[model samples]
Target: MVLFVIGIIACEKRLDEEVFSELAPSTLFTSEKGLSSVLNSSYAYAHRPGFQDSWAAYHLASMTTGEIWGQGGSIENLWLSEIDFTWDGNHDHIIAQWTIYFNSIRDANIVLDNLDNEEFSNEYKQLTEAEAHFLRGWDYSELYNLFGPVPLYKTSTDDPLLPRSSESEVQEFIEQELLAAIANLPVQAPAYGRASKGAAMAVLCKYYLNTKQWQNAADVAEDIQDLGVYELLPNYGNVFSIDNEGNNEILWALPKDATSPTASQAIDALVFPPDYPRPNPNNIVFAARTYLYDDFVNSFDENDTRRNYIITEYVSTTTGEIVPGLGDDRSFPYKIEFDPGAVGAAAGNDIPAIRYSDILLSRAEALNEISGPTQTAIDLINDVRTRAGISPLTLAGFTKETFREAILQERGWELFFEGKRREDMIRQDVFISNAVSRGKNAKDYHKLFPIPQVELDANPDLVQNPGY
Candidate 1:
């Protein structure tokens, strides 16, 4: 994707009366009580419309499907076209992402600025600042990866708008911020949703992985694994179930409170059984293109419980002939879970950001980059598969390259539809060429998403990406 500069709404210099007056600037620094609210707002931005559950997040995940949405006049169809530089101003993904990310950035900036003052004691201030930096880095890292370069905002300034930084500069800055954050942040936060040292390191690892800084990425993954706070869930199915939340296997997740409508809504209801009395645009009926491949669907042995848990034999009730149960062989494979009565609203099911399985694969990938597939790498990979109840492959037959390939396939199985396939393809250097071979309308220029035309027209200082 290309960098987009839009007319970002400026944040108020002072907090609004209704929201900020309760805690005046005087009160904000009087004690740690005022500062805790700052963290709450950051978490709120994370879950709100312009952020986490918004179109920006969802569409990024969906586009990896490489097909336009089946419905003729859908927002995602525009993304499919945009992937080939064939889209125009109506590109909702770009617009939504631009608005939400910038808004979140502004909020993070406010938090960072307020936390820098000396009113609070050094230790608490340092911890709070670490949290703010982690969030700021997270926002910039997303921008740097999806769009090549983005304006780096450190404070709320009244000066003229800044031009975008180079991608490398942005990435380096993000890495620095995460390093600072990891040092100051606690190993674990009081709440699961709050960013922790482990989470910061995980994000840092991803940043290195994206740039193909394999050695750095491996080192970071190793650091995260060394924390020992996380472990693989005994069963893959348990990881996705609502009951399984708060499981130690999850390093971090977006909090979805079912009681409060503002809390996270269950995501499965929207993506799963469409006709099961849910949202208006109920889970759009779609099948996994990869599961159709024999290597993926049948990769597991009969004893592999993950095969049954993760890949449900997806059956479309709309087909009107037969409705195979989720795990039935006749059904297709898909993630299914739904909250009835929440139409066009957020789902209650928690969206996982980092999990033990992901860590395992990251470790395997990093080790492969470091020394080909060492026994540790092979053992880690096999550990995941073994937990899935799949028969372990002989370590004697594994080579570095072969093991790397297996890890990729394993990721497809483990993290599918979790918004990672495209990044994985990009990291592996196969995104563009593979899409072209798959008959997608891709070109070398299409490797990055186009800068929305509206943004190009509005921001005179902004530059359009190559093919757009």
Candidate 2:
């Protein structure tokens, strides 16, 4: 395994020169250090800022799904309009997300293309090649989830023009790449941010669940559990705490540290109350919805420990008085609580990409789908609930349909504000209906986002998704 030294100089140099150099891949892949440098650049792409502004995939997915809403203001309105479905293909965030994921895929392909060089040791080649495949699979998974079917670039090429692949084809590609990744990756990652066998399996499991391959999803999820590399953290709130990073529950995370070049947690800056004490006293306060929806908040049992992560009211740090979270200025997510020493957006908290709890829930849902409400399924769901300090559930007499809805609701409660709601709602076939019920101008075509007008103009071969 290549021992990655944490430094920006080498990675920056590789990224700067490799993309434009005709002979860089041949020269770089011949040496272990050279190949490691290129792989570092590919890994860095995972943490690149998604949207230019505070609006990111985390915010977009939550806002569009009605789990949150942007507080209205002049600067905020720019992205909020698009997020609320008022804008179209020309939206900046839409274009930025498309660019970010494609760029990541481009970098991953570059690493993959150089892996077969004869000079590299067989073990090193296998390790680095698996990492490249994992990164590529991950990028494609994000692209497929957000934009539906995107162009499948299997190798690094100078050609920027490629037609979009079919949705099934893209899913199949992701599945095959991740399977290859799983075969070579270790059960646990050697480093904090690196992907592992468990991480690859997690993504593949989700893919199966999305495609309604119940048995495959269940089997993959079960495989992860059997690996014994991860387990749920005892405290639900501690899962997101900066001090608790690399905990047993985290399967994969984007490593963020105060000293790193990319060293901030935007979620904290985006979801804090306006009057809350922050490192910068003048920092703009970004809130979630005016409230977390009465039904959502009410769904939790009174004893649920997870409720601590959602603040409905709090004592003002400046005024030393209680503040009510109601009306337009409502409850905000406290998952990314606060880093007392953190100033501006620089916090040491790592962003979780996949967690053990998610795997458990996926297993439960998949099992339920395959065989109504089995005890194994109920036990998995109850495991998550039990961690949240709620009473365990029993199969009792639930129909297949009722059990499916129950699992969906369980996912919402467990994964809210983690950027999984929109996809979950979409898979459940309630995305449009849910939006309409919440008083949005959502249409059936809105299910797949527009292919971004800029992309359409740049690539004549590209076809836009329906309704955009």
Best by TM-score: 2
Give the local distance difference test score of model 2. Answer: 0.74
Q: Per-residue CA lDDT of candidate 1, range 1-468, in tens?
A: 432111111123111111343325656434566556555555555544322344346446445444212222233365456444465435676666665556667766756767766667788788878877887777787777666787777785623256777877887789888999999999877455677888888888888877878888878878877898888878787777766666777776766644444454433432434433333463333221222234345565667675564434433446645454334322233443544433344454566777778877887898888788787887888878888777776668778878878888888777765667777877777777777776777666654555667767777777777766
- CA lDDT, candidate 1, residue 466: 73
| TM-scores vs. true structure, each candidate | 0.81, 0.90
The regions of model 1 sitting more than 4 angstroms off are 1-38, 48-56, 65-76, 79-90, 158-160, 258-266, 273-303, 309-321, 324-336, 340-345
Misplaced by over 4 Å in model 2 are: 1-29, 50-55, 72-75, 260-263, 278-291, 317-319, 326-329
Instruction: Compare the candidates by lDDT and give the number of the best one.
Output: 2
lDDT of 2 by residue, 1-468 (tens): 342222112332122212313334455655776667667666666555322422467755776888876554443664476456775788766676787667667767877777777778888888888988898888888778878898889888756888998877898899999999999998867565777899899989988887788899999999999998889888898899877777889887766553343435555665666666555553435543233655676677899888777777778887978787643336767776566545455554667878899999999888887878899999999999999999988889898999889988989888877878888888889988998987888998887778889889999989998877
Candidate-wise lDDT, in order = 0.62, 0.74
What is the lDDT, from 0 to 100, of the residue 142 in candidate 1? 73
lDDT of prediction 1: 0.62
